[model samples]
Target chain A: MKIKSLTMILLAGTLAACSGTEEKPVDQNTPLPEVETVEDEAITAIPDDVDDGNAIDGGSDDLSFLEILDDPTSPLSNTTVYFGFDQHDVSGEYAPTLDAHAAFLMEHADLQVVLEGYADERGTPEYNLALGEKRAIAVRDYLQVLGVSANQIEMVSYGEENPVAEGHNEAAWAQNRRVKLAYSGR
Target chain B: MIRVNVFFILVVLCGFNAAVVKADLTFVVTDYVEDAIPIAVVPFQWKGKGQLPGDMAKVIDSDLSRSGQFKSMSRNKMSSKPHSPSDVQFAQWKRQGMDYLVIGSITPKEASRYSIRFYLYDVIKKTQVAAYTLPIHRRVFRKAAHRISDIIYQKITGEKGAFDTRIAYVTVEKRKKRRLYRLKIADSDGHNPKTMITKSNSILSPAWSPKGDKIAYVSFETRRPRIYIQEVATGKRTRLPSFKGINSAPSWSPDGRKLAVVLSYGKNPDIYIYDLRSRKFKRITRHYGIDTEPTWTPDGKSIVFTSDRGGSPQIYEVAATGGRAKRVSFEGSYNARPRVSPDSRKIVMVHRDRGSKKFQISVLDRETRSTLVLTSGALDESPSFSPNGRMIIYSTAGTRSRNILAAVSIDGLVHQRLAVQRGSVREPAWSPFSRR
Candidate 1:
């Protein structure tokens, strides 16, 4: 175990340098030029009620905007987004709900939400944990694309440990494999 | 009269379950080899002042039977209780269709110490094959019995016995609305069980130190998974620094100086080694795909882990220090949680059979690269090999679906299940040979 530690130190430095250079090309190729246009469009597209930042008199207060989360009929009420087995893709079915959440986060900068990813009790625990994280990160990326600040989104994964349904059937598994959009400090 | 009185009390306390005696736990061989060697272990005569520290003969019988190597003769059929070769009951045992006989006596010597004399006899040859007198502590009398079984087993099978080792496992129980998780350690025969930690959260992936004095396990008490190493005897634990993401799947090096763990503080779950002496952490695998469940090779030169870099999860091996990983499994679409045998000649993992769509424990020969499925359960996983590499203990969930711990011989000849009435037990990690 000791014989290779010295070489490993050098390898890590080289790998870090390699990753640093790889990111530069992608940042220069895309996303930089459109950042201004996307932000301006997102600001103009905000709802009239949330456009006003006043909290008192039932205006665009942080609490008033959060009321959208509590409304049963609102798209923000859909806290869970289900995924196929071993998949992290955000399907089209959840696009509207996620878009609602992205718009809400853009409207309320103080609102911080945690995306807790989970998997069913099937694969190995460690692998499931990675899969769960992948699901959360995929949602995080989608929110980022919608102009939601990355700092407002916290990602966590419970893997298959915290199952909502205890049954081993497909119905229970489907319910358990999901990403829960848990809002805090509401 | 005294022996009869004590025996009666034990029988009643055991609820008339003749198959089990009053030990912390008892093992029943659910299956065994068809032509196992039959042997008779006479109840050890107690010439001491008080009752014998433990039923030594019963332990030996259970240890040997659990090994899938011997079929112990029922004690009720014994024609005589012999304490030494001079008792001369070989002819009677041979007539009972037994190949060997064991006899012993426990006599007190000094304060908290006793002299245990035992002899192994070849009934068919009518000769005593092995005999020894061991001075044992009253507290470790059961361990002495295991050591005696080990000696006798080595004499009979020419392979060192792992009966004196230990196993660490996690048990989960639902109480009201909360689930209780406990990290526990017990003897190889499921005796002297000690719970190291109990919490409302979860504990998983327990790895024993090379010396069997410390254990490394992942605890979710802090709300996120983090690795902790605790001294088994002292119960003192040191939780490693939690990174931004997961800090799980800890495995100890053969020299006990470092641990190979899976850390996802980066963008992906990767392998890292934490130095115990220097308190330094080094990254081993750098991949975008999932890389976890790191296990050290027997030589400690390389670590075999589960990686999905090639698309799906499979076993891979890389140097103990950071390096490129080489794929190790190819027969299955899914194989993960790889554990190497004591000799590093075989690897066991949770294998998903493509045809049946069932997950079972599968063994792969490192040399031959041939895969053999060792279990039939729908969900069999967390396989750990015995110190002697003769048996594997794993967790299995059946159709009715309550997870439990089970052990099978490497050859799949014998099988046994270990569980309590309630609670689910999983992740059985066989400890190395006992230091004492």
Candidate 2:
């Protein structure tokens, strides 16, 4: 049975590889994932932190000075991004925060992080679980666009189980539906 | 019309009577009983030693009352309490307008055992209907009472009873900024709740094995969701294959040899059949949308699940052997968590009521293709069918606590609730009749 399943996995991998020749040929052991579109423009700072962005980017781009992560004033300090009701799209407003975090992650390539997704207590837990994953994936897509490697992010969704605010009102729900960036060992 | 209230002096016993070690859950009930088969349950004559461990009559009476089928005559209304049919005055009960009469006596045996004998009588005909004497240990005094309730229910309704079955649920509480999740199992009446797993992580979607000896659930103790199967008797756990992304919603197949689990493989979630003996997972559906909450039809031919392939979440059916996925629900924009009845005629699910915009429990008739909402809660989810498929138990927004477990008859006539003292409970899974 083990051999049969292994053979089936190999066949699936081979079929996926053959169906998408445009996909990277380097990895034939897995299926081709949806390619993320990386924006060509450099990262932008939130309007309120234009002066701070300049001072942080003044050095060589290759340098991995991650001091901005500890700086309370840096936009990178805001590790969480909130979502609207039943929405997974990373809003245009959160782009600056995502970009700053992505730039920091791109410089610190040796470090890895986990994007933890969550949802409010409105919907069924299983459906909310998938919604949470979609929320995390949206953040992951934005980070990839800012040049963060996909391998550096691991997504874990808590669904509606882990709630920051326990109230049953919309104020609590809005705070519950979110994704937070946390450092990972890998 | 005058409303009647029933009071039961509940007894809390320790240790499990059957497969568990210990037990915690508190329950109070609110029911609507109108024109139910009026019956009288005379307190069983327990004249033995130090306070009988538990009241057999209270347990039996409570079961009948909550079922919304029989309204036990209030104790204060009964002018005479009899211990047997020979001692019963049928004219007196008939005068009180009770259709049926119940009388019993208990004899305590040495070493914490009881010889319980009970009877049901037709007051109008003055004929003895049914009698049973159950020799039981004090540990199983309540279980024995439930056993009597099951027999009485089956005899009067000519159908199977689910009073002796069990339900598994998940509880979550936030303490000191940390979350604690626990999976618990208890009697059908929400008594003797035994903790199966307790940790400072997230646990959800607990499903009982067909034999009622094991369970499958998703736990996040490792900081990621992974499916695990645990033995109810020994509390042994075995983790299934965890992929890169999500590994949640593990459901046991009816025959108990395979599991219908949801796996994302680091991308889109899909349903898969995992064979326990072979330890192999065969992916069934391929879609970009989230396909989860899989439940197998009792016939084991098809799997009904919730999917968002059509923009909004809806129920879909896919052949177990791998085929095209067909949408099966059209009543509303959101219908999920489908649990097929044991008889294969109806399906209970969590549906968003189009008018109220609240998630409620609804039943769909397979032959008619129509849906009927059964609950009126702001948020109701995780509906599981009783072994007989006559009732559905789910967790919903609670008036007793923040969240509580509730049950309703398939006909939507009766309602019952089980609440804990602290935290909240969700994801209730009812066990099949323990064939043993």
**Each candidate's interface RMSD:** 12.5, 11.6
Fnat of all models, as shown: 0.15, 0.21
Pairs in steric clash, model 2:
none
How do the residues B1-436 of candidate 2 rate in per-residue lDDT, one tens digit apiece? 2234444223333322343333355444455556678888888998597565666777788788778778778788989999966788889999999998888899988988889999988889888889988888977777888888888888788889888889999888769887788999988877777889998988889999989999999887866677889999999998875555578888888899999888765566778888888676776776777899999999999999999988888999988866778988998868999999999999899888566568899999987989988888878989999999988999998763378888888887667767565788888899999774
The DockQ scores of all candidates, in the order shown, are 0.11, 0.14
For the predicted complex of model 1, DockQ is 0.11
Give the TM-score comparing model 2 with the true structure, all chains together: 0.84
Among the numbered candidates, top DockQ falls to 2
Residue A184's C-alpha lDDT in candidate 1? 60
* DockQ, 0 to 1 scale, candidate 2: 0.14
Model 2, position A133: C-alpha lDDT score:
90
Q: Which regions of candidate 1 fall more than 4 Å away from where they truly are?
A: A1-64, B1-26, B398-400
